[model samples]
Target: MWSYVGKKSNPRWLWHAIDHRSGKVLAYVFGRRKDEVFLQLKELLEPFGISRFYTDGWGAYERHLEALKHEVGKQNMQKIESKHINLRTRIKRLVRKTICFSKTIQMHDIVIGLFINRYEFEVSI
Candidate 1:
């Protein structure tokens, strides 16, 4: 799944893949909302051996994942959507119209990445 960041005109997308059953974020990438970005996330998730993918009917998912392994609907994607809400509440940068936002693309990704790593994955910097 992808979420927007930065200014509207010069927005960046944060792409993340989560394990449906575990509700744990498996991998995340920061980039534009394009096929290349989704591909990068998919590549990162290769080691996990993902058998099924639940998404919000994005075109990229249709192109990338096999039809049988992919299911599109809000019902199956509730966990990830909930995570987005949690992230927006916890991370000010993710909230729309927030004054406290990263000025640069690199910083934006770095801050969110650090937060996810430290809090979500429990990895020490």
Candidate 2:
């Protein structure tokens, strides 16, 4: 998903992979919406042994993930999309046109990272 830091023009993308069965986040990365950033998320998911991937029709996913294991459509991606909604609700920084926003990229990632670790993963850190 796309979020802004410092200003509306400065965009950053949150890339995450979640397990369909458990509805648990496998890994996440924050960066520009580019192939390199997608590759970084993919690398993080390598250890999870993910066989199938359901995602939107993003060019990077098509280029990086195996064709046979990739499925593109909104229908199959409902869980992740719902997760995004919940994230935006809980993390005000993710909401568009909000007064609550991080002034720096470092702070943006740190706040979201803490939320995910505490709530999503049930980790104290």
**Candidate 1 accuracy as TM-score:** 0.93
Best by TM-score: 2
lDDT of 2 by residue, 64-112 (tens): 9899999989888888988899999999999997999999999999999
Residue 42 of model 1, lDDT score: 94
State, as a TM-score between 0 and 1, how close model 2 is to the true structure: 0.96
Q: How accurate locally is residue 52 in candidate 1, as Cα lDDT from 0 to 100?
A: 90
Q: List model 1 lDDT by residue over 67-93, tens digit each.
A: 999988988878888889988999887
- Where is model 2 poorest over a 10-residue stretch in terms of lDDT? 116-125
List per-candidate RMSD values in Å: 1.5, 0.8
When summed lDDT is taken over every stretch of 10 residues in candidate 1, the lowest stretch is 1-10
